[model samples]
Target: MEKPQRGIQSIEVGGRLLTTLAEVGEPMTLKDLAQQSDMPAAKAHPYLVSFGKLGLVEQDAASSRYELGPLALQLGLACLRRLNPVRLGTHAATALAEELHQTVALAVWGNAGPTIVHIEESSHPIHINMRTGTVMSLFKTATGRVFAAYLPDKVIEHYIDTASHHSFAYPKSDLRPSWKAMQKTLKEIRAHGMAQVVSEPLPGINALSAPVFDHEGHLALVITVLGPTALFDPALDGDNAGALRACCAELSHRLGYAPE
Candidate 1:
Protein backbone atom coordinates (compact mmCIF):
# COMPACT_ATOMS: atom_id res chain seq x y z
CA MET A 1 0.00 0.00 0.00
CA GLU A 2 1.13 3.57 -0.67
CA LYS A 3 2.20 5.56 2.36
CA PRO A 4 -0.54 7.81 3.76
CA GLN A 5 -0.27 11.53 3.15
CA ARG A 6 0.21 13.67 6.25
CA GLY A 7 -1.62 16.86 7.27
CA ILE A 8 -1.72 19.22 10.25
CA GLN A 9 -3.24 17.47 13.26
CA SER A 10 -4.42 20.69 14.92
CA ILE A 11 -6.47 21.74 11.92
CA GLU A 12 -8.17 18.33 11.76
CA VAL A 13 -9.00 18.53 15.45
CA GLY A 14 -10.46 22.00 15.06
CA GLY A 15 -12.48 20.84 12.06
CA ARG A 16 -14.38 18.42 14.30
CA LEU A 17 -15.75 21.37 16.28
CA LEU A 18 -16.98 23.03 13.12
CA THR A 19 -18.50 19.81 11.84
CA THR A 20 -20.34 19.31 15.14
CA LEU A 21 -21.86 22.79 15.00
CA ALA A 22 -22.98 22.31 11.42
CA GLU A 23 -24.56 18.99 12.23
CA VAL A 24 -26.30 20.29 15.33
CA GLY A 25 -27.56 23.20 13.22
CA GLU A 26 -28.02 25.70 16.10
CA PRO A 27 -26.22 27.84 18.58
CA MET A 28 -24.54 25.63 21.17
CA THR A 29 -23.12 26.39 24.58
CA LEU A 30 -19.41 25.79 25.05
CA LYS A 31 -20.04 22.81 27.31
CA ASP A 32 -22.41 21.18 24.82
CA LEU A 33 -20.15 21.86 21.84
CA ALA A 34 -17.09 20.41 23.52
CA GLN A 35 -18.99 17.35 24.72
CA GLN A 36 -20.42 16.73 21.23
CA SER A 37 -16.95 17.17 19.69
CA ASP A 38 -15.52 14.64 22.17
CA MET A 39 -13.03 17.23 23.45
CA PRO A 40 -12.57 18.99 26.79
CA ALA A 41 -14.03 22.52 27.04
CA ALA A 42 -10.58 24.04 27.53
CA LYS A 43 -9.28 22.36 24.37
CA ALA A 44 -12.28 23.40 22.25
CA HIS A 45 -12.21 27.04 23.48
CA PRO A 46 -8.83 27.80 21.88
CA TYR A 47 -10.07 26.46 18.55
CA LEU A 48 -13.31 28.49 18.84
CA VAL A 49 -11.33 31.64 19.57
CA SER A 50 -9.21 31.06 16.48
CA PHE A 51 -12.35 30.30 14.43
CA GLY A 52 -13.95 33.54 15.66
CA LYS A 53 -10.97 35.55 14.40
CA LEU A 54 -11.18 33.78 11.02
CA GLY A 55 -14.96 34.48 10.76
CA LEU A 56 -15.80 30.79 10.65
CA VAL A 57 -17.78 30.92 13.91
CA GLU A 58 -19.20 33.43 16.39
CA GLN A 59 -20.59 33.42 19.88
CA ASP A 60 -23.88 35.07 20.77
CA ALA A 61 -23.47 37.96 23.21
CA ALA A 62 -26.81 37.33 24.94
CA SER A 63 -26.98 33.52 24.87
CA SER A 64 -23.25 32.91 25.06
CA ARG A 65 -23.69 30.14 22.47
CA TYR A 66 -21.65 29.47 19.36
CA GLU A 67 -22.97 29.35 15.79
CA LEU A 68 -21.50 29.44 12.28
CA GLY A 69 -20.35 32.89 11.13
CA PRO A 70 -20.82 34.99 7.98
CA LEU A 71 -17.79 33.51 6.25
CA ALA A 72 -19.28 30.02 6.66
CA LEU A 73 -22.54 31.23 5.08
CA GLN A 74 -20.58 32.61 2.12
CA LEU A 75 -18.70 29.33 1.74
CA GLY A 76 -21.95 27.33 1.77
CA LEU A 77 -23.56 29.63 -0.78
CA ALA A 78 -20.50 29.38 -3.04
CA CYS A 79 -20.68 25.59 -2.96
CA LEU A 80 -24.44 25.53 -3.63
CA ARG A 81 -23.97 27.86 -6.58
CA ARG A 82 -21.43 25.54 -8.16
CA LEU A 83 -23.77 22.51 -7.91
CA ASN A 84 -25.81 21.35 -10.94
CA PRO A 85 -28.86 19.38 -9.81
CA VAL A 86 -29.32 17.57 -13.12
CA ARG A 87 -25.69 16.44 -13.20
CA LEU A 88 -25.79 15.30 -9.60
CA GLY A 89 -29.19 13.62 -10.00
CA THR A 90 -27.98 11.73 -13.06
CA HIS A 91 -24.98 10.42 -11.17
CA ALA A 92 -27.27 9.30 -8.33
CA ALA A 93 -29.68 7.64 -10.77
CA THR A 94 -26.88 5.61 -12.33
CA ALA A 95 -25.87 4.19 -8.97
CA LEU A 96 -29.50 3.54 -7.96
CA ALA A 97 -30.19 1.69 -11.24
CA GLU A 98 -27.25 -0.63 -10.59
CA GLU A 99 -28.21 -1.13 -6.94
CA LEU A 100 -31.85 -2.00 -7.61
CA HIS A 101 -31.42 -3.54 -11.05
CA GLN A 102 -34.28 -1.41 -12.32
CA THR A 103 -34.70 1.44 -14.74
CA VAL A 104 -34.03 4.77 -12.97
CA ALA A 105 -34.95 8.17 -14.40
CA LEU A 106 -34.49 11.82 -13.38
CA ALA A 107 -37.18 14.40 -14.10
CA VAL A 108 -37.36 18.17 -13.72
CA TRP A 109 -40.23 20.59 -14.21
CA GLY A 110 -40.31 21.75 -17.84
CA ASN A 111 -42.56 24.31 -19.48
CA ALA A 112 -44.89 21.51 -20.51
CA GLY A 113 -44.73 19.49 -17.28
CA PRO A 114 -42.41 17.09 -15.48
CA THR A 115 -39.98 16.06 -18.23
CA ILE A 116 -37.58 13.21 -18.13
CA VAL A 117 -34.03 14.56 -18.44
CA HIS A 118 -31.93 11.44 -17.89
CA ILE A 119 -32.36 7.66 -17.73
CA GLU A 120 -30.18 4.80 -16.48
CA GLU A 121 -31.34 1.54 -17.99
CA SER A 122 -31.21 -1.70 -16.06
CA SER A 123 -29.34 -4.85 -17.06
CA HIS A 124 -32.72 -6.47 -17.63
CA PRO A 125 -34.64 -4.71 -20.40
CA ILE A 126 -37.89 -2.87 -19.64
CA HIS A 127 -40.05 -2.28 -22.71
CA ILE A 128 -41.19 1.25 -21.92
CA ASN A 129 -41.35 4.06 -24.46
CA MET A 130 -39.80 6.55 -22.02
CA ARG A 131 -36.80 8.63 -23.08
CA THR A 132 -35.19 12.00 -22.50
CA GLY A 133 -37.69 14.87 -22.96
CA THR A 134 -40.71 12.66 -22.49
CA VAL A 135 -43.34 14.65 -20.56
CA MET A 136 -45.10 12.57 -17.89
CA SER A 137 -48.64 13.06 -16.60
CA LEU A 138 -49.02 15.20 -13.53
CA PHE A 139 -51.60 12.79 -12.09
CA LYS A 140 -50.82 9.43 -13.66
CA THR A 141 -47.06 9.08 -13.36
CA ALA A 142 -45.15 8.56 -10.11
CA THR A 143 -42.51 11.01 -11.36
CA GLY A 144 -45.06 13.73 -12.13
CA ARG A 145 -46.97 13.20 -8.90
CA VAL A 146 -43.76 13.72 -6.93
CA PHE A 147 -43.43 17.15 -8.55
CA ALA A 148 -47.12 17.87 -8.08
CA ALA A 149 -46.89 17.05 -4.40
CA TYR A 150 -44.03 19.48 -3.79
CA LEU A 151 -44.49 22.20 -6.42
CA PRO A 152 -46.71 25.22 -5.92
CA ASP A 153 -50.48 24.82 -6.39
CA LYS A 154 -50.64 27.53 -9.06
CA VAL A 155 -48.15 25.72 -11.28
CA ILE A 156 -50.03 22.44 -11.00
CA GLU A 157 -53.36 24.16 -11.60
CA HIS A 158 -52.06 25.80 -14.76
CA TYR A 159 -51.09 22.42 -16.18
CA ILE A 160 -54.39 20.93 -15.09
CA ASP A 161 -56.35 23.60 -16.92
CA THR A 162 -54.49 23.14 -20.20
CA ALA A 163 -53.82 19.43 -19.94
CA SER A 164 -56.30 18.69 -22.73
CA HIS A 165 -54.58 21.14 -25.08
CA HIS A 166 -51.22 19.40 -24.63
CA SER A 167 -50.34 16.14 -26.40
CA PHE A 168 -48.92 14.43 -23.33
CA ALA A 169 -50.13 10.92 -22.55
CA TYR A 170 -52.13 10.67 -19.33
CA PRO A 171 -52.90 7.08 -18.49
CA LYS A 172 -56.44 6.58 -17.21
CA SER A 173 -56.96 6.74 -13.45
CA ASP A 174 -59.83 7.28 -10.99
CA LEU A 175 -58.29 10.59 -9.96
CA ARG A 176 -58.65 11.88 -13.52
CA PRO A 177 -62.39 12.37 -13.09
CA SER A 178 -62.31 14.27 -9.77
CA TRP A 179 -60.14 17.24 -8.75
CA LYS A 180 -60.85 16.68 -5.04
CA ALA A 181 -59.67 13.09 -5.28
CA MET A 182 -56.53 14.19 -7.03
CA GLN A 183 -55.80 16.58 -4.17
CA LYS A 184 -56.17 13.72 -1.69
CA THR A 185 -53.71 11.66 -3.73
CA LEU A 186 -51.20 14.48 -3.72
CA LYS A 187 -51.53 14.84 0.05
CA GLU A 188 -50.88 11.13 0.48
CA ILE A 189 -47.78 11.35 -1.70
CA ARG A 190 -46.40 14.05 0.56
CA ALA A 191 -47.22 12.02 3.65
CA HIS A 192 -45.46 8.94 2.28
CA GLY A 193 -42.49 10.98 1.05
CA MET A 194 -42.80 9.20 -2.30
CA ALA A 195 -45.26 8.28 -5.05
CA GLN A 196 -45.97 4.88 -6.55
CA VAL A 197 -47.76 3.58 -9.64
CA VAL A 198 -48.86 0.04 -10.22
CA SER A 199 -49.58 -1.26 -13.75
CA GLU A 200 -51.43 1.90 -14.82
CA PRO A 201 -49.18 4.08 -16.96
CA LEU A 202 -48.08 0.81 -18.51
CA PRO A 203 -49.35 -2.69 -17.97
CA GLY A 204 -47.06 -5.04 -16.06
CA ILE A 205 -44.98 -2.11 -14.80
CA ASN A 206 -44.59 -0.45 -11.39
CA ALA A 207 -42.67 2.60 -10.25
CA LEU A 208 -41.62 4.46 -7.11
CA SER A 209 -40.44 8.06 -7.15
CA ALA A 210 -39.12 10.47 -4.54
CA PRO A 211 -38.22 14.15 -4.59
CA VAL A 212 -34.81 15.75 -4.05
CA PHE A 213 -34.72 19.23 -2.53
CA ASP A 214 -32.09 21.97 -2.70
CA HIS A 215 -30.58 24.14 0.04
CA GLU A 216 -33.64 26.38 0.03
CA GLY A 217 -35.99 23.39 0.41
CA HIS A 218 -37.16 23.70 -3.19
CA LEU A 219 -37.79 20.60 -5.20
CA ALA A 220 -34.67 20.06 -7.31
CA LEU A 221 -35.73 16.94 -9.22
CA VAL A 222 -37.54 13.62 -9.00
CA ILE A 223 -35.88 10.22 -9.18
CA THR A 224 -38.02 7.27 -10.27
CA VAL A 225 -37.28 3.57 -10.45
CA LEU A 226 -39.41 1.17 -12.40
CA GLY A 227 -39.55 -2.50 -13.30
CA PRO A 228 -41.99 -5.27 -14.20
CA THR A 229 -44.94 -5.51 -11.83
CA ALA A 230 -44.22 -9.12 -11.00
CA LEU A 231 -40.66 -8.31 -9.92
CA PHE A 232 -41.17 -4.90 -8.38
CA ASP A 233 -42.97 -4.38 -5.09
CA PRO A 234 -45.11 -1.24 -5.14
CA ALA A 235 -45.46 -1.16 -1.37
CA LEU A 236 -44.53 2.16 0.24
CA ASP A 237 -42.90 0.20 3.07
CA GLY A 238 -41.03 -2.29 0.91
CA ASP A 239 -37.27 -2.68 0.54
CA ASN A 240 -37.32 -1.04 -2.89
CA ALA A 241 -39.07 2.05 -1.57
CA GLY A 242 -36.67 2.20 1.37
CA ALA A 243 -33.69 2.14 -0.96
CA LEU A 244 -35.16 4.83 -3.20
CA ARG A 245 -35.94 7.08 -0.21
CA ALA A 246 -32.41 6.63 1.13
CA CYS A 247 -30.90 7.55 -2.24
CA CYS A 248 -33.05 10.69 -2.49
CA ALA A 249 -32.23 11.69 1.10
CA GLU A 250 -28.50 11.45 0.41
CA LEU A 251 -28.86 13.46 -2.80
CA SER A 252 -30.88 16.11 -0.93
CA HIS A 253 -28.15 16.34 1.72
CA ARG A 254 -25.50 16.78 -0.96
CA LEU A 255 -27.57 19.62 -2.37
CA GLY A 256 -27.51 21.30 1.10
CA TYR A 257 -31.10 20.56 2.11
CA ALA A 258 -31.55 20.27 5.86
CA PRO A 259 -35.07 19.06 6.54
CA GLU A 260 -36.95 20.65 9.45
Candidate 2:
Protein backbone atom coordinates (compact mmCIF):
# COMPACT_ATOMS: atom_id res chain seq x y z
CA MET A 1 0.00 0.00 0.00
CA GLU A 2 1.10 3.57 -0.67
CA LYS A 3 1.55 6.12 2.10
CA PRO A 4 -1.74 6.77 3.87
CA GLN A 5 -3.01 10.32 4.00
CA ARG A 6 -4.52 11.82 7.16
CA GLY A 7 -8.07 12.64 5.95
CA ILE A 8 -10.26 12.19 2.89
CA GLN A 9 -10.86 15.32 0.79
CA SER A 10 -14.57 14.60 0.40
CA ILE A 11 -15.05 14.23 4.15
CA GLU A 12 -13.24 17.49 4.79
CA VAL A 13 -15.52 19.27 2.30
CA GLY A 14 -18.57 17.76 3.99
CA GLY A 15 -17.22 19.00 7.31
CA ARG A 16 -17.33 22.53 5.97
CA LEU A 17 -21.01 22.05 5.28
CA LEU A 18 -21.64 20.70 8.76
CA THR A 19 -19.75 23.60 10.31
CA THR A 20 -21.78 26.06 8.24
CA LEU A 21 -24.95 24.51 9.59
CA ALA A 22 -23.64 24.72 13.14
CA GLU A 23 -22.49 28.33 12.71
CA VAL A 24 -25.89 29.31 11.38
CA GLY A 25 -27.47 27.43 14.30
CA GLU A 26 -30.51 26.57 12.19
CA PRO A 27 -31.73 24.22 9.49
CA MET A 28 -31.29 25.25 5.88
CA THR A 29 -32.32 24.17 2.42
CA LEU A 30 -29.77 22.42 0.18
CA LYS A 31 -29.47 25.50 -2.02
CA ASP A 32 -28.91 27.75 1.02
CA LEU A 33 -26.38 25.35 2.48
CA ALA A 34 -24.51 25.13 -0.78
CA GLN A 35 -24.50 28.89 -1.16
CA GLN A 36 -23.29 29.36 2.37
CA SER A 37 -20.66 26.66 1.91
CA ASP A 38 -19.58 28.31 -1.38
CA MET A 39 -20.15 25.13 -3.32
CA PRO A 40 -22.56 24.13 -6.11
CA ALA A 41 -25.87 22.64 -5.00
CA ALA A 42 -25.20 19.40 -6.92
CA LYS A 43 -21.90 18.91 -5.08
CA ALA A 44 -23.40 19.71 -1.68
CA HIS A 45 -26.40 17.40 -2.09
CA PRO A 46 -24.41 14.18 -2.56
CA TYR A 47 -22.31 14.87 0.54
CA LEU A 48 -25.48 15.67 2.52
CA VAL A 49 -26.99 12.41 1.30
CA SER A 50 -23.95 10.54 2.57
CA PHE A 51 -24.12 12.43 5.83
CA GLY A 52 -27.79 11.53 6.18
CA LYS A 53 -26.99 7.86 5.62
CA LEU A 54 -24.29 8.01 8.29
CA GLY A 55 -26.71 9.75 10.70
CA LEU A 56 -24.59 12.87 10.72
CA VAL A 57 -27.27 14.98 9.11
CA GLU A 58 -31.05 14.77 8.83
CA GLN A 59 -33.69 16.26 6.56
CA ASP A 60 -37.24 17.26 7.28
CA ALA A 61 -39.51 15.69 4.74
CA ALA A 62 -42.22 18.23 5.39
CA SER A 63 -40.07 21.32 5.03
CA SER A 64 -37.12 19.90 3.06
CA ARG A 65 -34.73 21.50 5.53
CA TYR A 66 -31.48 19.88 6.60
CA GLU A 67 -30.12 19.84 10.13
CA LEU A 68 -27.58 18.01 12.25
CA GLY A 69 -28.78 14.52 13.15
CA PRO A 70 -28.72 12.32 16.26
CA LEU A 71 -25.14 11.21 15.81
CA ALA A 72 -24.00 14.81 15.80
CA LEU A 73 -25.93 15.35 19.02
CA GLN A 74 -24.34 12.23 20.49
CA LEU A 75 -20.90 13.51 19.52
CA GLY A 76 -21.64 16.98 20.88
CA LEU A 77 -22.94 15.57 24.15
CA ALA A 78 -19.89 13.35 24.45
CA CYS A 79 -17.67 16.42 24.00
CA LEU A 80 -19.69 18.47 26.48
CA ARG A 81 -19.49 15.69 29.06
CA ARG A 82 -15.78 16.28 29.39
CA LEU A 83 -15.83 20.08 28.97
CA ASN A 84 -17.82 21.32 31.94
CA PRO A 85 -17.90 25.16 32.00
CA VAL A 86 -16.62 25.50 35.57
CA ARG A 87 -13.84 23.01 34.94
CA LEU A 88 -12.81 24.78 31.74
CA GLY A 89 -12.99 28.19 33.41
CA THR A 90 -10.74 27.18 36.28
CA HIS A 91 -7.62 27.21 34.13
CA ALA A 92 -8.35 30.71 32.83
CA ALA A 93 -9.31 31.99 36.29
CA THR A 94 -6.13 30.72 37.85
CA ALA A 95 -3.99 32.24 35.12
CA LEU A 96 -5.84 35.54 35.41
CA ALA A 97 -5.28 35.65 39.17
CA GLU A 98 -1.59 35.07 38.69
CA GLU A 99 -1.41 37.67 35.95
CA LEU A 100 -3.27 40.42 37.81
CA HIS A 101 -2.21 39.46 41.32
CA GLN A 102 -5.82 39.81 42.54
CA THR A 103 -8.67 37.67 43.67
CA VAL A 104 -10.32 35.90 40.71
CA ALA A 105 -13.65 34.13 40.81
CA LEU A 106 -15.78 31.96 38.54
CA ALA A 107 -19.50 32.30 39.05
CA VAL A 108 -22.39 30.30 37.63
CA TRP A 109 -26.07 31.09 37.61
CA GLY A 110 -27.23 29.40 40.80
CA ASN A 111 -30.89 29.28 41.80
CA ALA A 112 -30.33 32.30 44.03
CA GLY A 113 -28.21 34.29 41.53
CA PRO A 114 -24.62 34.63 40.39
CA THR A 115 -22.91 32.28 42.86
CA ILE A 116 -19.17 32.12 43.23
CA VAL A 117 -18.23 28.50 42.58
CA HIS A 118 -14.43 28.98 42.57
CA ILE A 119 -11.89 31.52 43.78
CA GLU A 120 -8.15 32.06 43.39
CA GLU A 121 -6.58 34.49 45.78
CA SER A 122 -3.68 36.81 45.08
CA SER A 123 -0.35 36.15 46.73
CA HIS A 124 -0.36 39.71 48.00
CA PRO A 125 -3.32 38.94 50.27
CA ILE A 126 -6.50 40.98 49.91
CA HIS A 127 -8.87 41.88 52.74
CA ILE A 128 -11.96 40.12 51.41
CA ASN A 129 -13.48 36.78 52.30
CA MET A 130 -15.07 35.55 49.04
CA ARG A 131 -15.31 31.80 49.32
CA THR A 132 -16.67 29.06 47.12
CA GLY A 133 -20.48 28.82 47.27
CA THR A 134 -20.69 32.47 48.26
CA VAL A 135 -23.51 34.06 46.26
CA MET A 136 -22.61 37.46 44.71
CA SER A 137 -25.21 40.17 44.82
CA LEU A 138 -26.87 40.83 41.46
CA PHE A 139 -27.15 44.56 41.94
CA LYS A 140 -23.91 45.36 43.71
CA THR A 141 -20.95 43.18 42.78
CA ALA A 142 -19.22 43.23 39.40
CA THR A 143 -20.06 39.57 38.70
CA GLY A 144 -23.75 40.13 39.47
CA ARG A 145 -23.83 43.13 37.10
CA VAL A 146 -22.42 40.95 34.31
CA PHE A 147 -25.24 38.42 34.75
CA ALA A 148 -27.86 41.15 34.92
CA ALA A 149 -26.38 42.70 31.79
CA TYR A 150 -26.72 39.43 29.82
CA LEU A 151 -29.43 37.24 31.38
CA PRO A 152 -33.09 37.29 30.38
CA ASP A 153 -35.34 40.01 31.77
CA LYS A 154 -37.36 37.59 33.92
CA VAL A 155 -34.25 36.15 35.52
CA ILE A 156 -32.89 39.65 36.10
CA GLU A 157 -36.12 40.64 37.80
CA HIS A 158 -35.95 37.62 40.09
CA TYR A 159 -32.41 38.41 41.18
CA ILE A 160 -33.16 42.10 41.47
CA ASP A 161 -35.90 41.27 43.95
CA THR A 162 -33.58 39.03 45.92
CA ALA A 163 -30.70 41.50 45.95
CA SER A 164 -32.92 44.45 46.85
CA HIS A 165 -34.77 42.81 49.68
CA HIS A 166 -33.16 39.70 51.16
CA SER A 167 -29.89 38.33 49.80
CA PHE A 168 -27.48 41.27 49.63
CA ALA A 169 -26.05 42.73 52.81
CA TYR A 170 -26.13 46.27 51.47
CA PRO A 171 -29.38 48.05 52.24
CA LYS A 172 -31.41 50.09 49.74
CA SER A 173 -29.82 53.31 51.02
CA ASP A 174 -26.39 52.05 50.00
CA LEU A 175 -27.61 51.08 46.54
CA ARG A 176 -27.24 54.40 44.82
CA PRO A 177 -28.68 55.41 41.44
CA SER A 178 -32.43 55.43 40.82
CA TRP A 179 -34.11 52.51 38.99
CA LYS A 180 -33.90 54.30 35.64
CA ALA A 181 -30.28 55.22 36.25
CA MET A 182 -29.44 51.63 37.07
CA GLN A 183 -31.00 50.52 33.81
CA LYS A 184 -28.80 52.95 31.93
CA THR A 185 -25.75 51.66 33.78
CA LEU A 186 -26.65 48.07 32.97
CA LYS A 187 -27.15 49.02 29.34
CA GLU A 188 -23.64 50.45 29.27
CA ILE A 189 -22.38 47.24 30.88
CA ARG A 190 -24.04 45.14 28.17
CA ALA A 191 -22.64 47.33 25.41
CA HIS A 192 -19.14 47.05 26.84
CA GLY A 193 -19.58 43.28 27.54
CA MET A 194 -18.22 43.80 31.06
CA ALA A 195 -19.05 45.43 34.37
CA GLN A 196 -17.14 47.42 36.97
CA VAL A 197 -17.96 48.46 40.49
CA VAL A 198 -16.06 50.69 42.91
CA SER A 199 -16.81 50.57 46.63
CA GLU A 200 -20.47 50.76 47.94
CA PRO A 201 -21.12 46.99 47.80
CA LEU A 202 -18.00 46.36 49.84
CA PRO A 203 -16.03 49.35 51.00
CA GLY A 204 -12.50 49.75 49.63
CA ILE A 205 -13.03 47.01 47.04
CA ASN A 206 -13.01 47.41 43.26
CA ALA A 207 -13.93 44.75 40.71
CA LEU A 208 -14.31 43.95 37.02
CA SER A 209 -16.32 41.13 35.44
CA ALA A 210 -16.98 39.71 31.99
CA PRO A 211 -19.59 37.21 30.84
CA VAL A 212 -18.80 33.84 29.29
CA PHE A 213 -21.25 32.58 26.68
CA ASP A 214 -22.01 28.92 25.91
CA HIS A 215 -22.58 27.24 22.56
CA GLU A 216 -26.24 28.25 22.64
CA GLY A 217 -25.19 31.94 22.84
CA HIS A 218 -26.55 32.24 26.36
CA LEU A 219 -24.74 33.52 29.41
CA ALA A 220 -23.07 30.46 30.92
CA LEU A 221 -20.86 32.07 33.56
CA VAL A 222 -18.78 35.11 34.50
CA ILE A 223 -15.15 35.66 35.41
CA THR A 224 -14.57 38.30 38.03
CA VAL A 225 -11.44 39.88 39.48
CA LEU A 226 -11.48 41.99 42.58
CA GLY A 227 -8.93 43.80 44.75
CA PRO A 228 -8.58 46.71 47.13
CA THR A 229 -9.53 50.11 45.63
CA ALA A 230 -6.15 51.55 46.59
CA LEU A 231 -4.57 49.32 43.96
CA PHE A 232 -7.40 48.34 41.60
CA ASP A 233 -9.49 50.80 39.62
CA PRO A 234 -12.80 50.01 37.91
CA ALA A 235 -12.65 52.44 35.03
CA LEU A 236 -14.71 51.76 31.89
CA ASP A 237 -11.62 51.18 29.74
CA GLY A 238 -9.02 50.21 32.29
CA ASP A 239 -6.15 47.79 31.74
CA ASN A 240 -7.55 45.21 34.18
CA ALA A 241 -10.99 45.40 32.54
CA GLY A 242 -9.39 44.65 29.16
CA ALA A 243 -7.56 41.66 30.60
CA LEU A 244 -10.72 40.34 32.25
CA ARG A 245 -12.65 40.73 28.97
CA ALA A 246 -9.96 38.87 27.04
CA CYS A 247 -10.02 36.01 29.55
CA CYS A 248 -13.81 35.72 29.43
CA ALA A 249 -13.79 35.81 25.63
CA GLU A 250 -11.21 33.05 25.57
CA LEU A 251 -13.30 30.90 27.89
CA SER A 252 -16.42 31.62 25.84
CA HIS A 253 -14.64 30.45 22.69
CA ARG A 254 -13.78 27.19 24.42
CA LEU A 255 -17.49 26.80 25.17
CA GLY A 256 -18.19 27.09 21.39
CA TYR A 257 -19.34 30.70 21.20
CA ALA A 258 -18.68 32.26 17.80
CA PRO A 259 -19.27 35.93 17.83
CA GLU A 260 -21.35 37.35 14.99
Choose the strongest candidate by lDDT: 1
Tens digits of per-residue lDDT for model 2 on 102-162?
A: 8898999987578899988887667776789887766778888888789887876655556
Indicate the worst ten consecutive residues by lDDT in candidate 1. 166-175
Tens digit per residue, CA lDDT, model 1, 1-260: 99999999999999999999999999999999999999999999999999999999999999999999999999999999999999999999999988988999999998778999999999876998999999887777899889989998887777777666655645334225566667898899999999999997799999999999998999999999999998898899998999999999999999999999
Error (Å) of candidate 2 at residue 198 is 3.9
Report lDDT (CA) for all predictions: 0.91, 0.84
TM-score of each: 0.91, 0.74
Runs off by more than 4 Å, candidate 2: 1-10, 29-32, 38-43, 60-65, 77-83, 98-102, 123-125, 153-180, 199-205, 215-218, 228-239, 253-260
Model 2 / residue 3 / CA error / Å: 18
- For candidate 2, give the lDDT: 0.84
TM-score of 1: 0.91
Name the weakest run of 10 consecutive residues (lDDT summed) in model 2: 168-177
